[model samples]
Target: MESAVLTQALMRPAAYPHPVSKVTLIETHISQVFLAGAFAYKVRKPVRLAYVNFASLATRHADCEAELRLNRRMAAALYLEVVPIIAGPGPLDVRIGGNGAALEYAVKMRRFRQRDLFSTMAEADQLTGAQIDTLGRQIAAFHESAPVTGHASGHGTPARIAEVMEAALNGVAELASSTEMTGRVAALLRTRAGSLQPAFHKRLASGHIRECHGDLHLGNVALIGQKPTPFDCLEFDEALRWIDTISDTAFLFMDLLHSGRQELAYGLLNAYLECTGDYAGLVVLPFYTAMRAVVRARVLLERAHQRSAAGAITTAEMATTQMRCNDLLDVACFALTRRPGAITIMHGLSGSGKSTVAQRLALAGAMVCVRSDVERQRPPHGHTAGGGDLYAAAQTARVYRRLRAVCCLGSGAGFPMIADATFLARGHRQQFASLAARRVVSFSIVDCNADLATLRERIAARTGQGRDPSDASLQVLALQQRAQEPLGSDEWRHVVRVGEPAAVE
Candidate 1:
């Protein structure tokens, strides 16, 4: 039950009851995972960190139980059970709930291919926008089902959020490039926190605070048979796990931004709002996102410190750490300082580069783009996929309806929205214009224009690739051209031409 003995036992795969082929040991700051045949055993390290306590065998055992209980909510099949490590004559062995005095406890899990991880998929470009959309809905559903912490629980209140932010910023200030940058972040946090207090209090009153997956990022999710499953939630600290739903999701959004996947992050946010109908939650999202960035900086700083303490730090490595720290600081500051966004609609046929411009706007952090193609392909819950009728009049109407709803939701959340669609119909364009007017937000229509030959060529090329969300082909493009309505005089004033300069307001 000593550290050395535990390490030795984990190193030998034969110690486990399962058939042993090879033993893969993965270590983190607070735990060690031994992946053997058909299973992964996660054993907590005997470290009593500020946020977690796993120092004693009894404590680890209870923690393992908690991990099993909490993670199963989102990933039931993966979290198998908690097993005990029993002492033996020659070596420590996993008892699998047999009768014996246990030395330590490990959370057992069904082993999965590392390649199926969301992070790995992202690196390989195998993660689709539709999958990201599904992930948001799943998270929203999870939050809905999760037990809400009572207001009296003293968790997830505006005061607590401010307290946590101040503590986290103060804790990481020493690692910042200068005290001035730290001071600026603190000031921004104070201002944003004060502004967001009312929204936070409202969320707390409305039961939006619940137990959440505190560490939701690409790494904690995996594609199991094409379903994105999130696991390995923070089980050690209730304070960390119980939070406003948007704040919890901001971690994933901030991670995507950090990794340069801002477009997907924006789509995920839009889809989450569509699922949860919590548009007002946007008021606190910037603050939550900044806090997540600051948390990432704190972690990176801790890593740099550990390397420095060990006398193993290299100049290049130190430089990389410092650069990342500065980058996160900048992101935190940017999120806090972002201007209120306006609604923009991409108005053009598929081959005209409407999606491209929409994505550009989203990456610029101007607004979240909601695409008609992706949403059309996504079937409702318990519904089967329809055929080529996706472009039929009724189906097209449904798509536009959904698009309008999503735009309204985003606008209500105070996020600028971009409707990425052909918008070939004046009625559809007017619907969004009306929504913008009602929402009291500025509106603009981006008309992507190209020659007929160029449009045909682009559509052909896109169809050949077969990876595009759009299914439009030359025939479809022709049909669209014939049916498309030109922008009206009123709509022309709001149109921004993408290709050639046209007379505009």
Candidate 2:
């Protein structure tokens, strides 16, 4: 359709009640988009394909309406109702004539500033860690509220995964042959496909499938008044929309890594896991992320092909694309096979830098630190006791029990658990060692010791900063010193004198 015709169609009362003096056509390969006033309208091109079909005006209208309905689930306030435009005798007529003949349908939406998108924010380093945590919680809640279908939806099944893989391989092969994605990339794609087929089937049987946002990426997310909101869901195909939940999340994770936000990527993944409690899904993430990356690579290659004659798909550009594909495939391989494990326990008196060290180690992905100070402060029987009532043996036993349980669980899940506690006695260390032995995992304990003056200074500084959780007064520290026992020869223990960096190292 001509730009004028499309503009006129958008101006119809059925499309937009308000007057629009000017309209801008945003041309995309798959759809004809128009920006009218404060609203954006999208109309699919008249084409029939294997994955999507909009061959007729009626089908396009129905799809438009479908898109409006589905996207409203996430962006309800943004996706306005769809409107039908009728064509008459005039070439660009939008009003109804003798018979109201439908000309086209437009998917209307609230216009958002392009610069407010997550992709732009990430490029500017404005997508903070806190924002990513919020995004994780929001997406977790969305997935929980999303509708779940039966087996007939063709989701979470071996056949469905096979179909998706076959389609992706076919698309990649066609793009590679027509474009310049040859040599290492072509070989890597084949190798990844072969390695992933078996795991795909296993995941299908494990009921890891759900209806998901098929095309989740940075561009599809926008920050509206500082909150990340996802929009423009893929409504053209049910098969594409219904997929493994991990596969859905992997798209954004891969996109983040591709955009050079590995820290945020890891944080997002960790936040999502903490929220959804889906640790089992981690095993399938690599394969899903790899597939998502290759899908994008293939789409980029196809775009390159369309501009081949314009020198856009040059030999050098093709090589860059190949390198990206290889990198993604390598990440997938490493994610699937490499199982990282390490345990670093922090033992010290109150205000000895255990929490600070634990925080740094956790952020570095070195260990999952469990802080006893934090755990002990938790309710039921925390630090409310006076001198006579404080340090109850039963309370100490309960804290140790909780610590051992968390350590065992983390170790069993393939992540070394770092237990941060005041190991004042040999019994305390022995309890953790027993638990590690039961799980067939190794444990390392680092004893942190500081002078009385240094400990007092650190404790005062922590209190000034409002970060310390301990109630260790000078009297409590003196009591702790008297109660503490020296460590004997133990292979797992290492003594580190705090505030003396050279000696510790």
Q: Pick by lDDT: which candidate is best?
A: 1
* Prediction-by-prediction clash tally: 0, 0
Candidate 2, residue 267: how far the Cα is off, in Å:
1.0
lDDT of 1 by residue, 308-412 (tens): 876868978988988888788888898888654578888887677787777767756747777888877877545787766788898899889878877775566
Per-residue C-alpha lDDT of model 2 across residues 1-505, encoded as one tens digit per residue: 5544666665554444556666776644357777777878787877564477787787887888888888887888888878766665456556422246567777878888878889898888878878887887787777766766575666766566667766775766666543343344445545655665666566555555667788888878998777888988878888888887778888888888787787688667656654554545655566677678767766665556555745656788777766665565555444444343445567778766676666555656635566666556554323453344335677677777767766665565455567778887789888877776677666677767666787887767666787566656667677778988777687444454456622331
lDDT (Cα, 0-100) at 191 in candidate 1? 87
Q: Over 4 Å off in model 1, which ranges?
A: 91-97, 176-178, 303-318, 345-366, 369-414, 419-442, 446-491, 496-505
| Candidate 2 Cα RMSD after full superposition onto the native fold (Å) | 7.0
Instruction: Give all TM-scores, in the order shown.
Output: 0.75, 0.70
lDDT value for model 1: 0.82
Candidate 2 backbone collisions, by pair? none
C-alpha lDDT values of all predictions: 0.82, 0.68
